[model samples]
Target: MTSITIRNVPDEVHRALRIRAAMHGRSTEAEIRGILEQAAKPEGRLKLGTLLNSIARDAGGLSDAEARRFDKLRDRAPAEPMRFE
Candidate 1:
C-alpha cells in the first residue's frame, strides 16, 4: 500500500477534521482515508429515459393520448434562435 503526506493544513481545518473523526468514532487518519476514498470514487450515472420510465411506472403509466401528444410536441420544428449581437 502507498502512503501520502498532506502538509501545511491550517489549525482550524485540522481541528475540524479531529472533531469530525471523533463524531464518526474513527481516528483522524481513518477519517481522512474515508473522505479521500469517497471523493475519489466515481458516481453512478443515471439515464434520463430510465429515470422517467421508473417514475411513469410508479405513477401508473401515461395515457395513450398523452404519449401521442408528447410525440407530436417532440416532432415540432426547432424554436427561433436568439441573437447575442
Candidate 2:
C-alpha cells in the first residue's frame, strides 16, 4: 500500500472530518480514504478495460487461437531509449 501526506488543512475542515468519522463509525483516516476514493473513482465510472472489451465484442471477438497467436507476437524485450541528434 502507498501512503501520502496532506499538509495545511484548515482547522474547520479537520474538525468536520473528525465529526463525520465519528458519525460513520470510522476512524478519521478511514473516513478520509473513503472520501478520496469516492472523489477520484465514483460508482458507475467508465473504465478503460471495460470499454475496450465492449468494443472488441462489438467487432466480432477473436477466437482463442487467434488471441494466442497475437499474444505470441508481443515484444517481450524492454524498450530502448531514444537517441537524440
Candidate 3:
C-alpha cells in the first residue's frame, strides 16, 4: 500500500475532522476515505423534469403548480444569521 501525508492543515480544520471522525466511529483516515468516495461520485446529469419528479415522489407526489409554489416559497425564505447569540 502507498502512503501520503497532508501538510500545512489549519488547526481548526484538523480539529473539526477529528471530531467528525469520532462522531461517526471511524479513524480519521477512514473518515477521509469516506469523504473522498462521496466527493468522487459522478455529478448526476438528471433533467429538470426528472429531478422534480424524483423530489415529488419522495414528498408523496406534489402537482406541478404545487411544486412551483414550493420553489417560490423556498426562494423567498430568509437566510439565517451566520452566528446566533
Go through the candidates in order and give the C-alpha RMSD of each one to the true structure.
Answer: 12.4, 6.6, 13.7
Q: Write the per-residue lDDT of candidate 3 for residues 1-85, one digit (tens) a residue.
A: 5676989999998899999999999998999878876787636756566687668768888877877676666544556869876
| Residue 37 accuracy (lDDT) in model 3 | 68
Model 2: ten consecutive residues of lowest lDDT: 48-57
lDDT of each: 0.81, 0.85, 0.78
Candidate 2 segments whose C-alpha is farther than 4 A from its true place? 57-85
- Local accuracy of candidate 2 as per-residue lDDT tens digits, 1-85: 8998999999999999999999999999999999999999899999665576567656879665765665588667767989998
Mind giving the per-residue lDDT tens digits that candidate 1 earns over 9-81? Answer: 9999999999999999999999999999887763665756557756775697876576556656663555688
Lowest lDDT 10-residue stretch of candidate 3: 41-50
Q: Considering lDDT, where higher is better, how would the candidates rank from best to worst?
A: 2, 1, 3
Q: In candidate 2, list every pair of residues with a backbone clash.
A: none
For all predicted structures, in order, the TM-scores are 0.50, 0.60, 0.45
Better of 2 and 3 by lDDT: 2
